[model samples]
Target: MASKTSAISASLLVAGALAAPSASPADNDGRRARGEAALARITGAEGRTVVESIRRTSPELGDWIVDFAYGDVFSRPGVALCTRELATVAALTALGNAQPQLKVHVEGALNVGCKPDEIVEIIMQMAVYAGFPSALNGIAAAREVFEKKGVRTTAMEAAQPVAPAR
Candidate 1:
């Protein structure tokens, strides 16, 4: 049963990621500009901060996140942002080992209009398939995410550009 659900989830993710319009060299600049803007709109200010931190830690990863994940995958037109985040939250919960990422998506879910109870029920439903431990951990992570909204990812502080002397 769990395997079936996992397969279904995987299929949905793949389906959601179907190719978008091709990007030309000339269009790359425009697409990227639009991607960045869309990323900002969906993720909100806190997400931008985390993206900056991610960029500092891993330039390639950060680019893929903003460019591919948020820019391309997320900006895909078929699904609305709320639905997308719900899928993300469900997938993370089903994995039973993605608490940290779950927290972020849970917050993203809220940013995109999912209410707290809705999120609670989402994870609560996972308790059966994923087991109590995974659900507990996910709930805990969600609590922490709600308590504190911003991130200071590893090396982000160190990588911060220092201000010029006055």
Candidate 2:
């Protein structure tokens, strides 16, 4: 069941990605510009902080993050920003070794209008493929991000009381 869902998702992502118009060589500057805007849109003010931190170590990587990740991939018209952020959150969670980046995308997920419960569900869903350990870490990351953003998780949502069986 999970494999089928994953396969369908992968197919959709590939099809949508292929549908995006390719950037031309002359679009280098344009790509950078679009990337900067996309990064700002997705990550808000933290985008600059992320870039600056990366620049302190590898300036070119920073440029690539903006120009390639944000500019070229993110700016593509196939997927909505919120959907992309959710997908990113899922991928990072599945990787299980990128807690910091996962946290960033968790925040990005919220910024792009993914509900706290929705984000939690996505991470929890990853457990099926990424294992409980990865899912647990992803939940921890999501919890921290939710705390910082002051959003409530599904764990914190109120549930209706159930009557005892007679």
Model 1, residue pairs in steric clash: none
Reference-based TM-score, model 1: 0.65
**Over 4 Å off, model 2:** 1-29, 159-166
Best by lDDT: 2
TM-score for candidate 2, residues paired by index? 0.77
Candidate 2 Cα deviation (angstroms), residue 122: 0.8
- How much lDDT does each candidate structure score? 0.75, 0.89
Q: Tell me the tens digit of each residue's lDDT in model 1 across 1-166.
A: 9999999999998887775554542256555666677667666776778778987989767777777777678878989888898888878988988876787788888788776667777777889888888788877777677668553323334577989999
Q: Give each model a TM-score.
A: 0.65, 0.77
- Residue 106: error of model 2 in Å? 0.5
Clashes of 1: 0
Among these predicted structures, which one has the highest TM-score? 2
Error of 1 at 73 (Å): 1.2
